[model samples]
Target: MTRMRAKPGRRTPVGRDSRDSLRRFVEMLAEKHPPLSLDAADLTIKDPEQVRRRFGRVFGYLTRVELEVERNVLELRVLMPESTETDRIFYEQVWWPQELQHGVLLDAAQQGFGMMPVPIDVARVSARIRVTGALSHLPGMLGVIRLLYYLTGAATERSAVIAYSRLLDGLRAMGEHAIAETVIAPIRRQEPGHFAYYRGSAEALVKEEGLSDWQLQLARILRRRSFAPVGVTSRRQRADFGDVARALHLDRDLPAVARQISLVEHELLWAQQLGLKVPRYIMAALDEAIALSTARSAAQSVRN
Candidate 1:
């Protein structure tokens, strides 16, 4: 057992309504959610052909992203220098270690089908982000940055929960029970706690006076301008994300998927519009990724 390194969260991380619950949640996370075991999972591929193409692509991209948690942590430190201790504890202590292990399991599963490990770039954050992180240290700016962090966390984990759910079901449908149960189930179970923490923390900040109206507006703008599907860094990567969505069948019901991801932002940033379904920017990003994927396929077909 790798010793869980988080301090039992002793401070109010979010505000009053959710602070107690979120703190308890954090404690639960530290105590209960160690990384899923690597050796215990039977990475047996009942039928490698069943999952080797589309499903393997999904695993490849998923593995690449989870392994990049190290980079995410480094970027977080640079981006939110004024982050709370609890934030530090969650990301560094709990989230990073667990996610890196997820990458391991996913990589192993994909390799069972003879898939190559996806190339990853955990090198460093872009120069732009470093500058922005430095600027985030300005007074009253860190609150906005923190709230955005929570919001980003919420959306990313929600997407993960949905993707893992779909993947789990798909595996069972194909009778890939061993990895489905041991690998995917264990991984999927650990995700909701992360989602809860992010959702609760973001909800706490948005509902309380943690962010001013200007800060909220700023967050809205930043998210609109900069939202990319989690772990996507390039056009090729965006297309790969689209491949994951399609393989998982999330592309078929994009509004529903988009709703899951963008719901919090809509509630927080567009509180007046009760009838709004999905944010335009999120939908646009998804659409573009899928379209890019389609174009990539067409180009490949022409070449072939």
Candidate 2:
């Protein structure tokens, strides 16, 4: 038999022209993150009815968060009132539709599970909110905002990937393979595209604005205060982390949550590359937990 060269699978390139970057980002978002194969027998759903019931709670929360993000973008546009030719087109044609699509996808996912979609209404804030956001949009401030947005975005997307990956693992452990493959896996795949967009946009924005050390410090501070897990938010009295943790059956301990958050921060290499200023409380907790986990594994190996 003749030797043949191997072909590469479809994967996005990290460093590339903006058009290529954007295209790859979109493809990954649209196609790659979701899982295609699952063995239903491997899942742990003991009662289909209970699974169906819980699905409503999970889907409702996700839909609402998606809408909240869209509203933020819309309101930002309203406040800034984009006057530039380019800004207007970008907001009208690109950003608006993308955020809206997030809501649409979440709704579709909810409908697939026979759940009612959640309603979202943007809070009416005075122009002061816009003015503050605009001030942050100054050439210097905009660079900081863009960096924080994208870096935090990278952190957020990576967190989604990890969280969903764990969800799937739990599903498989529970023998709920169908939902894992159909619902959870698909949502996981969408994250990479979101990640790519944030990463690409951050690179472009940083380069364009010539970011400074002070600006970078500011970005980190803002990111920590504003960070929220993807597909969930810590906003409004109605939206609580406890609700999310319960729905996902995630570990409720502060250390565990901090570890998961740190996994996201580590995956994105934000702390090192971006010099992100993570909260000391989170950092201390994660450090101790990680150290203990590592030491346990090492001790186990020695015993073996």
Candidate 3:
């Protein structure tokens, strides 16, 4: 059995509102939306050619990222050494199990279209992450890191909610309602809970002075300088995310989507600049990803 690594002095949060909110949400995880059942998928592929042509890339990308939840948990354990027991319960217990099921289900969906399982990176946690974990061990650093996690989680899930919705529509338009209802709908339903968990916790922390001036300042600087698109650690993955964004039509409303993704961060970290339309780091990452993806597609077309 793999040991669940944690730091000393880690405990549950003491406050009532945020703690209670998260605690209630965790309870709701099992009660509200138990792990998705791949066994129950209707698994009907209406048109293999159409499904492959329209959704294969998006499904493959989503499946690989979702399946990488194990790696994410490992990263979390290393990066948030000061995590409370509640945090552990949420990430390791509630979140991972559901997200893992999502991966399995999505893989099943992609395979239904005759596509092989997308490869996932579930083992390596990388040297850069370990160094960040080292920083997390410092005083007051855990809270900063945890908040960043919450903010990022909110943006990521929000993106999923939108993407899944678009996928559902496309599937329905193609008369692929069986997979849409069985796979896409259930997965999309569970996403908001994850988003709520992150958004509520981040909002509460921001509301209650859960951080200090210097810490907040440092957080702002780090966020502006170091922010990357969620789950993107490589140029290939970045381009894949851009493809997912464009496939889901997220690129059509980049400013609005960017604002929604970074809402909590804007309110919490960006100096009350209510007028801040989009965070430069996020928009820039997406733009670059889209550019790379477009160039690659153009090159492929030329070669063909």
Candidate 4:
């Protein structure tokens, strides 16, 4: 776990509007949007030679997406001690199952084309992260951490939406209509609601009294220091992320995606510096990881 420094602030009262918004969001999540059914009909790929080949790459990406559910269980525990149980109930019962099914569907698609699903190593929280979580049980720390989680979640889901949209388009262009509708479409539909929760929480929490300038400063530092693609701690995962980016032609669009992620944070922390731009660590990590993956593939070809 990454560590940082900041003074604790006072807890702020949640506004009626914010509270109402959360209630509505939670209710919406409780409402059923049934998970995708992965049957032979929906799983059918129209252009196996073209689309399935690319889906082999998409499988790499979806595995990471699905695995985040497991990681988020731990993340919810660490970031929001006050609401962990409530959030955990929703995640385990609802969100986790849906996203995990997305992984299952994608994995099935990959298997249809005879590709293996990428292995996921569930991340263990480091001592620093545990200490941070414990410290969050203190007065001011929880608010800041929770705010960071919302910001992170919003950005992550936004990026996923973009990636999935483009991937669906790519598949359709390759005449893989079934995959465009069946696999990617349902998966993409699920993400926006997740983004809405995070965006709404970040917006609401930032205005609360408990959040302070020092905590915001610490958040800025954490955003800069700790930001990376989901489940990308290891070199192998990073390489896989790189391969997916290239396969989806996302290398160019990534900077734009990073900016979208940074927008809410920039407004929260440095309104005057709204125009401020720093190198996006996520983009750099993907680029470097992709380079490593590419080199390894080339080396393997030579070996073969």
Per-model TM values vs. the true structure:
0.92, 0.60, 0.92, 0.84
- Clashing residue pairs for model 1: none
- Tell me the tens digit of each residue's lDDT in model 3 across 1-304: 1212223443323233567767877887868888899999888997988899878889999898789999999999988877878779888888899999999999988898899987789999999789988998788787778778888898889878888999999999999999999999999999988887887777666555357766777778888777777678889888888877777787888888887777767766773566666778888987888888888888889999
The whole-model lDDT of each prediction reads 0.83, 0.53, 0.81, 0.69
Off by over 4 Å in 4: 1-16, 39-41, 84-90, 277-279, 301-304
Where model 2 places Cα greater than 4 Å from the true spot, the runs are: 1-13, 16-48, 52-56, 76-116, 122-129, 170-178, 203-209, 230-239, 252-304
Model 3 lDDT at residue 74: 96
Task: Kindly report the root-mean-square deviation of model 4 from the true structure over all alpha carbons.
Answer: 5.4
Tell me, by lDDT, which candidate is best. Answer: 1
Tell me how candidate 1 scores on lDDT.
Answer: 0.83
Candidate 2 lDDT trough over 10 residues, lowest sum: 1-10
Which lDDT tens digits does candidate 4 get at residues 1-304?
2222222452212223666656666666758565667773376765566665665766766765686577667767765667644355556666777777788887777776677667665566666677778878876778778777777776777778877888889878887777678888888998887777666666666664346767777887887787776556778777777777778787767677666656666656656564565345655766687787788789889999
lDDT-wise, the better of 1 and 2 is 1
Report the lDDT of model 2 for residue 69.
Answer: 63
